[model samples]
Target: MEIKDLSGMRKDYVSEDFSEKSLLADPYLQFDKWFAEASLVEEFEANAMVLSTSGSDNRPSSRVVLLKKYSKDGFVFFTNYLSRKGREIDENPWCSLLFFWPHRVRQVRVEGVAEKIVYEDSLEYFKSRPVISQASSSLSLQSSILEDKERFDKMIESLVSSGEDIKMPPHWGGYIVKPERFEFWQGGTGRSHDRFRYDLEEDHSWRISRLYP
Candidate 1:
């Protein structure tokens, strides 16, 4: 395969404008507004976000994951608590979520602490998942070493044959990311991208300001 650097490829477009005042005083409201607008016009995974975490060793890591829910208080997503991301979260609760809607030339970055959802909350959402997914969760020991595909499939089949109630894996749970800061970016040509940042204060109020591109 030939490697071609597309970084130099530039596009010219005279389009949308974003500024400090263009956003709401409440960053959460502004996020909701942008989310709705993007959902209406963009075709890709609107709810997907790049989640970032730090391990016990303080090394940084990130991966794309679906955004499950959000509110004025926090954002919620589910995963196996024993997985890599989960272990990272357990060791260091702080995390960040990034959302990009390329078609709309917009991106949002959120930073916060991650906390486990209530057991009942986790149970409710777990039960709402597809039956097959529930079964997989029960059969899988997330982050555990496995021998091969044969062993994995056999475990799943054994669980299926038992025909017992598939209890929620104790290691499976949901985490809420209570955002302390949010940065909004709207792309512009010549690297003059529009950017705004909203930081939360101790009073639970937000301070919104425009940032250098």
Candidate 2:
């Protein structure tokens, strides 16, 4: 059988509502609650998110990455510093994070500037990773073009043969996206949606208000 078009096969929602009255004063707090709910649900890849970044020449690129942690400080994720995202962050620290939990019809968009963590912090996290991932961290020069696909495997094998502890590559690390603004969107039927946004105030507090969605 052949696959058919989905343009006329959209589904309707009969789930729940995200009301403005129930929202927390701080979007981060509300996000925490929703994230907790999503974590326990059977949603597909609950921690997966689309991270968008702008390059030095001003083009945009987005890819799915697993969110490692989130707190009042911001969202955190790890990446090879030599990857495309790393180069972009090195050029422009600003970026956006989009999280969608379709099972609950909830989504969140965060705009923030990223800052790299200190070596000590990166080291702690690096040590926590499984051995294979640590080996991969040393294999690829990240975004660099591969002359041969086997290079990485050979490199990993070499590292393993050397029988030494894997040290986190200098070009591998973590970044924290300290959110200045966050937009929460809950889906509604027939194009009607609910949106609430929270922005940081000058005094280190939060200002939240509803938005037309």
Best by TM-score: 2
Q: Per-candidate TM vs. native?
A: 0.90, 0.91
Clash counts for the predictions, in order: 0, 0
Q: What is the lDDT of residue 131 in candidate 1?
A: 66
Error of 1 at 187 (Å): 1.0
Model 2: ten consecutive residues of lowest lDDT: 12-21
All candidates' lDDT scores? Answer: 0.88, 0.86
lDDT of 2 at 91: 94
Off by over 4 Å in 2: 1-6
lDDT of 1 by residue, 81-102 (tens): 9988999998999999999998
- What candidate 1 gets wrong by more than 4 Å, as runs, is 1-3, 157-163
Deviation (Å) of 145 in candidate 2: 1.4
TM-score of model 1 relative to the true fold?
Answer: 0.90
- Model 2 per-residue lDDT at 79: 91
